[model samples]
Target: MSSPALLPLCLLLLGLAAPVLAEEAPTPAPETPAAPAAVAPALERSQEQQQALMRQLPAEQQKTLQAGDESFLALLMPAARAKAAGTVVLVPGDGESADWPNVVAPVRQQLPTFGWQTISLSLPDPYDPVVAIEQDTAPADTDAQANSEQAAPPVTGGSGTAPAAPTQAEAGSGEPAQAAVAPVDPEAAANAQATRVLARIAAGIDLALQQGASPIVLVGHGTGAYWAARYLAEKEPAEVKQLVLIDAREPQGMPPRLDATMGKTDLQIADLVHAPGAAAQRRKERAAQKANKGYRQIDLPVIPGDRAAEQEQTVRRLRAWLDRLPPAASGSPAAS
Candidate 1:
């Protein structure tokens, strides 16, 4: 119906519109895979717990110490009387806090009444879990069972032609091949932990010295004893003249064992052990006594379910031991 020139123009406009429409409708970009979320370190959790505990403590008694990038909690119980015997640096064992209800809290609270200042520290949790979780069946075992069933030939009602037996290659390779496991170096981990713990101990010693405490004593409970003994053996600070261990035990992955750690140190040590049938612990104490001239061992009766009695007896024995140490130089208080 239109003129010949108009038809050419219309064709040109339609061709232009077709190209524009094609350009507007482009393909969508591919989605990127999300990165795995970073996990919080185990130490962070312990620090969080420590912070919560610090909130519950009395402001006057609470103390915060900075060791490297981390801050640790310490509780200071000043002497009830004017003249303090000396400051006893208390390091709690694994799973214990600065004011743990067990021996740690009791000792820290009672020692001050006897004219001794107590500084209790909150130590880190064990690197490994104390009890491993059990699973019903391992993935590898399940896969192995499935592969064996698949490899077995099926039973037939009537055997016209028996199924061909599986080839040796197929049978041997049926189970998924296991990947090689990486080796772990326990000593390296222990050494790293020891380094951190030493820094904290040094900080505590500095605090004691600042308060004019003389003849500082390092007291460690359970695994903490190992740390105190190891620190004394390695650093041998002149200010810290004595070490006391209560219900002592070695930490996991630490080398040289508890007795060996105590034996190597020349510092005067009072090794106290409770509970029955502790043949191994007693033997180790004996070895340390034989090796070190200043080593003393005390066996206390374990009164289960009677925490007060146990703490009382322990304090009594410890007080007696402290009394026996050669009197400190004139004007210098002795360590308890």
Candidate 2:
């Protein structure tokens, strides 16, 4: 071959050989992603706590009741005497168990002796359920990249001032994608709590009726009073004839006011106001006055340093009030 032609052929051969050499070099394998760690399911705070509590209580007192989608615990003490006086469903306040020591425990234990069948319910915690979730921490690689960028000398322009690296908005646009969770709605959470509480209360009442007990009276303590009153005013169950509220306070941040709720029903009502200065206003409220001729608001003196005595005194007053009512009008579960 001539020299110029031979040179051209050699260049062509090298070009083909270069691609063959590059293809022979080993390529790195892709990395497999790490598996996600297991996460526990979210649970309602009150239900979880109460389930643990129910295990410690006596089996005899424990009653598993179902209401709507929820199953909850109730403590029942049948009438101590042969002749049943009546049934009283006790609804405890927020942060209290069915066997709460203060008013609920004492009343449920002692009331049966006075010929009353008592059942105390566990109320849900008035808050949104906590979700068990894992947050994505900033990737270690991201931090390393950020640090490397910060440490590097900026690229310069002809003017000598370094060209702008990148605006914050521009840099953020390339950030790795993350999980997006919507914020919980407060109104929806509150409504769910109210519905759950009301269902539990109704279940307790149904249990009493099933046992063939009559003259079912709903007694609510603390915020529970609001739930009980609201149930009565709304359901107007023919079986329940009276309501007793002890140290009653409406559930915070929600409601038809307790007074307005009371006004909706004509059932016999008693407001056992424990807070000083509350009795007078509760007495004058048009709701209470218009409720039934039987509505009465009585101020209770707090027995400081003696919880037992205070509970005893409250029970005594309740017993006396029951004695005043005419015999439960002929709606015994046995007769029905």
Q: Clash totals for all models, in order?
A: 0, 0
For residues 28-79, could you state the per-residue lDDT of candidate 2 as single tens digits? 9989978888998876666776777677877888889998977888888999
Q: In candidate 1, which residue ranges exceed 4 Å CA deviation?
A: 1-45, 129-184, 276-291, 329-336
The numbered model that scores best in TM-score is 2
> After best superposition, candidate 1 residue 233: deviation in angstroms?
0.7
- Candidate 1 scores a C-alpha RMSD against the true structure in Å of 12.0
Residue-level lDDT tens digits of model 1 in 1-336:
569879999999999899789989987999997987999666655576688777888888888887767678888989898988778899888878888787888889998999889898877666542221122122344444455556546556575656646645456776343433333345555666777888888888888887875657889888888888888878878788788888888776567676666656676778788853464466456665577677777888789898899888988888787767664521243332
TM-score of each: 0.67, 0.72
> How big is the positional error of residue 24 in model 1, measured in Å on the Cα after superposition?
14
What are the lDDT scores of the predictions, listed in order?
0.74, 0.77
Model 2 ranges with Cα > 4 A deviation: 1-37, 42-45, 128-176, 278-280, 287-291, 329-336
Worst 10 residues of 1 by lDDT: 129-138
